[model samples]
Target chain A: MRALLVVGGHELRSRLRDGTAPLIALVAPIMLATLFGLALGGDDDPPLKATIGVVDLDGGEFPASVQREALNTDELKGVLTFRQYPDEAAARGAVDGGEAGAALVFPAGFSEGVGAGRGGQVSVMESPESPLAGVVARSMVDRISALVEARTLAVRASLEAGVPADRVQVFVEENGAAGPALSLVGDPVAGGRVDLAVHYGAGMAVMFAFFVVGTTARSLLTERQNGTLDRMRAAPVPLWTALVGKSAVGFGLALVSMCATWLSSVLIFGASWGDPLGVFPLLLAHVFAATAIVMLVASRAKTDAQADGYTLGVAFVFAFLGGSIVPVYNLPEWLRGVSLITPNGWVSAGLSELAGTGAGPSAVLGPIAVVTGIGVVAGALALLGFRKGRFA
Target chain B: MTPALVCEGLVKRYGDKTVVDRVGFHIDEGEAYGLLGPNGAGKTTTISMLVGLLRPDEGSVRVGGIDVDEDPVAAKRLIGYVPQEIALYPELTARENLRYFGRLYGLPRRELTSRIGEVLDLVGLAGRGDDKVDTYSGGMKRRTNIAVALLHRPRLLILDEPTVGVDPQSRVAILDRVEALVGDGMSLLYTSHYMEEVERVCTRVGIIDRGRVVADGTKRELVAELGGTDRVELTLDGDVTAAADKLRVVEGVSEAVVTGSSSIRLLVAGGRHLLPALLAAVGDAGAVTGVEVVEPDLEAAFLHLTGSTLRD
Candidate 1:
């Protein structure tokens, strides 16, 4: 253990002095964060604000419940502002006049058809001026619609179980007037509205961290070529000591890259990374997974050039496909699922889920577990590769 | 005293190719032992096994009475190794490299601090130890490489072809430092293809050929086994091949072969006494232009044992 730490500290100092690592690991991500953040309305820009038109021809408890429960949640505090229109034509007029990005209109028989478990429909009007506002409105409406549909199915099941129709009606009225059965405050419209600067900042940190680890992992081949590795192996320490020590430096660089980007984003861009308690595990897990992946890449590579090429290749692939090059919310829905397969994807996703002031603490738990799994499996394979490789 | 290093049959193989065959030797405390061999003769492979950098497939090595396989850390603690290539980190200063390696061998921080200066001074690199290794000359880099190895003050120092590509002056300085180490009671295992270096620095030498130690003994003992024969080189003005044929039939000449365009080399029991017969036997072949008889040395012993010169 002493030897491991000594070797680790030595490698850290040596690489830090080289200056390339500090540039790639420490500075590059901050620059990316600033560039991407400024592109997406920097900290000094006005907070995202859009008005959403709402029309209630049904004038019933269900549409009122959705407006009060989902559309007005604190999660959309700075992004969405709701307006009540007297009817569908008024809402459409407001949307066409650019008073609202989009409007949701509930038909007169909508609640009656929903209670009857029959045909029901709602119409939406969107203006071309604010597509993102339309998206936020659609997401919130879709969530509320799904919640109502589930509740309607439960009513149908109870009615089939020989419950009275009047009692089911009473249940719906009481619950609809009360708090939402599924709260929208946790993940609602603003799920995608996570401060873009913070989201892209986290992604940049994640993507560039691979470069830091690449140098450390590629050192195995470099040292082997230059004969330094053989000299270390010639010492009294175990062969694994060299690998562990170098990897410890890699792990430190990963952590430092993340924290530096996070702190710099906060200080420079005024972006809050949600709660640190929620943020830390994702940082550790994502960094661990990134290190493991680069180690595996380096171990399989036969030469230093091959290792370098593969490291850059993997970094870019993860960055672009995992939503680092573009914000996760901007990626296609299918690509979002694909993004979770990458270490960068999980980090971007989890960090974005916990972005902003009201972020739920538990939002990062899922990504943490998944990224940690990635670390474990990749870490195991990397160990096998190192053992099988010429790391001796 | 138990030998400072002992190996009965250290073997290392890669698939069907055995790099280091059942090689065996022992070095007593403070004795400088040289393993002499040409390139690809398994000197580095053998040294790797001895230093615990490589695992022997079918044999064992004990350093300072500790079995390397059983207690590698302890066995390695007694050994310092210098590779043919300069192995110090290029971006690190010589002192930094020494300090790191010293810490690796478990030297305490205070001891390692002072010991780094001492080792640098010992290698004649004291004032320039602060410079990064990449900024140094080839010879300085080689010196720093040796300095890192000596930081821990191991009981045995194993250097594998240390002076292969160094300048003449630096080679002399390195040899001087190594000779001083030996004089200070440090056990040493030096491997090189240069027979003269082995003869000058080592008390005993092992001649290895094709992964096998053909002979190991003191210089005088190895040459004495040659039966006091002298090596004679005769430059003639006639056909060298004809001259070699004539010299082969001489009574005292054991072997005669054409060495160059007009020169014949002969291994003779008493070269000087047989000189007249050799010249007379060369009557029609050529008049002897220059005749030289040399006393036997490590080169002759190597040629005798391996049937090839060290240059081969």
Candidate 2:
């Protein structure tokens, strides 16, 4: 154990003095996260307001009411601004010219159809350039149409039941201004909000964690080539102790890089990592797994160039599969399934759950267990490689 | 007293080929034993097994009476290995590297510090201990490598070509330092292809070739085993064959041969003692123009045993 500490401390101190490894492990990840966060608009800045054109051709109380409600709805107030157009041609022109994201046109006699217990018709025009705004505008038009349909059903039911006309008119007038007939309540999505900034932050951290693999493998190969490893073996220290010490250096650097990225995401970008207790263990397990993988590569590699190529290839493949460069949610289902097979995938999934949904410690247990298991298996393989004299 | 290191019938093989076959030797306390071999002569391989870095296929290595294969950690504790390559971390200071290896040997902090200072001074790098190893000259790096091995003060110091690339002056310094250590009662198992180095430092020599020790003994013993004869070349102005015949009858001359029309070579038991009679014999045959005597050394001994030069 003392041998392990001494060797490990020496390895770490040497790396720290070298400076290149730490720069890649820490600064590179943070830089990637910042770039991705900026691109994704994951910060707390307000969203852009979309301009929507309203064309009321019905010249009736119902059309005017629909327009007023769509424009004045609390949910759409800051998000969607409206412009009243004189005609369909004007509204459509505004949408086509990109002056408005979308246009809503109420056809002539649309209010009369509802008054007579018949369905009303409305047309929505949206530009392809502003898809988000167009979708929002269409949903608002749908809500107004739903209200019209509900009123028509109520009026038809009253007449069929032989209610007095005067009472029916009073009912229509009273209910028309109330609200939409079907009020939709939202439930949380299984994975929660896919915060782009946090996703990229965690992804970049995990991806760059693998970058240390190349350095770790190169260092191992160099020590072997330079005869330092042989010298160490000749010392009183056990071979396993030296191996453990070298692995600890990689693991320690990875752990620090991962934690620093997480903390920076939280402090700088306002990213919530949910439960610290849950996230910390997963990070440790991830570092362990990453370190084991690198050690295994180093043990098997014949030269520094071979180690570099192998490690970089593995890191990239794992990063891509694990959705580090792109969100797994955005990937195909089959691709996402493939991601789950990698430790990076498990780590990303665990971090996403913790950061996105405020998941508890229990939520990350399975991933942590799997990652730790990988570390154990890979570490064993690495030791076996060492025993086989592959590193020699 | 127990020998500092003993390897009995050490054998190592890779795949179907044998790299080291039944090579065995021992280093006694205060003895500087030189393992002289040409390149690819299994010197490093044998050393590796002895130092617990490699397991012998058919032998046992005991360092300070501890079996290396059975308890390598204990055996290793008794051995300080200086590998051919510079093993110290290039980015770390010489002092830091020594301190690190010292700690690995389980030395106390104060003791390790003092030992580092002592080794630095011993290697003549006391003032430059704080400089990073990479910044040092090649000779300095080599000294630091040796210093690291001495940090634990092991019973046996195994040096594998410790002066391979060093300048002549640095080589002399290293040899001087190694000799001083031996004088201080430290055992050494030194391997080198340089015959002069072996002759100057080693009390006992083992010449290995093709995974086997072809010759092993003290320098004088090995030389005597090779008939203990020195060569004398006498350049004459006339009748070389007649001069050779006269030299053959000299008191200490082992054999005499005529090589050219004007030169006669004599194999003498002792050239310096036999030279006067050899001169008279040469004068009896012809007028002597020049005389040259070659003494029997490790190089000649090695060539005699292996039928090859040490450099080859």
Judged by lDDT, which candidate is best? 1
The runs of at least 3 residues in candidate 2 whose Cα sits more than 4 Å from the true structure, single-residue gaps closed, are: A43-192, A390-392, B228-295
**Candidate 2's iRMSD:** 1.3
Q: Encode model 1's per-residue lDDT on B1-312: one tens digit a residue.
A: 978999988778888998788999999999999998877888888888788777788788999999999999889989999999999888788988888888888989999999998999999999999998999988899899899889889899999888878898999999999999999999999988777788889999998888988898899999998887888889989888877887788898877767678877778888789888888999999988999999987777776777665655
Best by DockQ: 1
Tell me the tens digit of each residue's lDDT in model 2 across B134-252.
99988899999999899888889999999988888899899999999999999999998788888888899998999999888999998887575776778888787777777778888
Worst 10 residues of 2 chain A by lDDT: A183-192
Tell me each candidate's RMSD, in Å, in order: 6.9, 9.8
Alpha carbon deviation, residue A286, candidate 2 (Å): 1.1
Clashing pairs in 1: none
Interface RMSD of the candidates, in order: 1.1, 1.3
State the number of backbone clashes in model 1.
0
Model 1, position A388: C-alpha lDDT score: 64
Work out candidate 2's RMSD over C-alphas: 9.8
lDDT of 2 by residue, A218-258 (tens): 88788888888888777787766767677777777888888
Candidate 1 similarity to native, TM-score: 0.76
Chain A TM-score values, per prediction = 0.74, 0.67
